[model samples]
Target: MTTYKRMVLASRPKGVVSPQNFRLEEVQAPALKDGEVLIRNHYLSLDPYMRMRMEDVKSYAAPQAIGETMIGGTVGEVVESKNPKYAVGDKVQGMLGWSEMGVSDGVMLRKLDTTHVPLSAYLGSVGMPGMTAWYGLTQIMQPKEGETIVVSAASGAVGSVVGQLAKLRGCRAVGIAGGKEKCDYVVNELGFDACVDYKAGNLVDDLARATPNGIDAVFENVGGTIFDECVARMNPFGRIALCGLIAGYDGEPMALNNVRNILTMRLTMRGFIVSEHMDLWPQGLKELGTLVATGKLKFRESVAQGLESAPEAFIGMLKGKNFGKQLVKLV
Candidate 1:
């Protein structure tokens, strides 16, 4: 095909993201250069971090400019190649954005081994989310046996793995999710010790009951009230791995009322971007891939059918409408 479809940022979101913020358009696919590979993207990953990129405000990464293809992770099969490093029919992963097709010079793409893990998994459990969980739990939280470990957004792609890893390490895994279904999934499906539903309107009390021993380590995903409640229950010298703050991603500035807990409890909270620590990826992916390949690690996905569904699917994810990893199947 000479042309392909792509979703671009039509406008920066003011509060909550909506369909109007994205514009899907067809564009001419340029001919491959001497070192380029043409990939027909099969899946596109929708993540919370993409919300932060929608704003013009300063962040670790540049804001997605209006008219630029919406940034994302993708897994696809190379359909044509001019580069020796990659060949046609090689499945690969890259930051290819929300497009049906993308061209790469082999700098960003990495060939995948779909024999062990499914291709879609490269966008979820055995991919960035898994790496995030591993890095945060191992490099930062470092929970010891019998310690109470709490994770917010417990049913999400990252939080699910965090709690599972915590459980494997002999720590008591307590999850905090939005609803009863998600909480139940975290506890039963993912083997978390307990899961508290924040939307039940008894968050503080529910969390207290779940982490009766007091939180010793926390894998924080949703910030704002959920984070504040978790911090209020932290044990002295507890470690917190701050991954994402999806609760306040729309436009609201996050204000933690329990900031005093940090001082009183002497918490060690560290915020990290998974990509920054590339040194740990090989180790993290190896362990995660093994767990997944062996059936020790479990993950779920909520997929949208086509590329045109990306904007709506993304908005749903931001509102906690998706159960696990949200993905768009393009081909």
Candidate 2:
């Protein structure tokens, strides 16, 4: 039997998660069942949504149970297969968690053609985060030419794509990110019209300057003060797609001071989970894949060394340390 390493949720976190919250263990891989396919994960995706799973709270999805393998998305190659649908040597992506190897019955896995795009791209730009940006911007926001669209966490996996898509549709894209370096990348590389550094201590003023005509739409990822500032500058009939609230993911309570803007500005705000909208995945993924393959869309990633480093990398990502998509190079 082949032995593989995996990380399991040891305990629910209180406030911020630490290394102690996770336990690394080595387990022997079992022989494949009649319909099972075994994969050797090459890369593991680390995303913000994983944080919410760590808490034992009522949510759109169930909390990660203690002693369960830490949930995650992964890209890997099939090493053994008992199913006729999936052949050995096939590359696939699935919710296989934070393990060096995983087994599945081929229900949730999607085969990947790595010739068109890199393997890791399936975890970021042409994958869930990219699809998220598409659903939020094109469906909810519906931004038009000459309109101003603001995106929070602008240099992140979803936010970067949001800004780029807005610009592609002829809207003026403004981004809000953490530091000067990320802000620079958002503006210069991603083609955002302007980027404001939230940590610069001039969030409100900088936002005001960026959206001189007021924001027509917002792709909100970070909540709390940043969200409040965006709401305060929203134009009448503006749309807000509430994708994530990373600011409060560590159990902090986020209070929005601009609640009245929803009524006063006649704004429309919608909170959605990308997974729930399976109907749109085909359309969104096709467009995202084409854009990425054609070089029209761009993205970056911060890769950690191995499975053992996932905890620290995940903790750092929550604290805004990652530049773009954060991934663990399991291979």
Q: What tens digits encode model 2's per-residue C-alpha lDDT throughout 20-72?
A: 99999999999889999999999999999999999888999999999999999
| Model 2 TM-score, all chains together | 0.99
Please name the candidate that would achieve the greatest lDDT relative to the true structure: 2
What is the C-alpha local distance difference test score of each model?
Answer: 0.93, 0.95
Residue-by-residue lDDT tens digits, candidate 1, 163-233:
99988999999988888899989988999999999989999898999989999999988899889989999
Q: After aligning candidate 1 to the native by TM-score, how far in Å is the CA of 157 from where it should be?
A: 0.5
lDDT of 2 at 176: 97
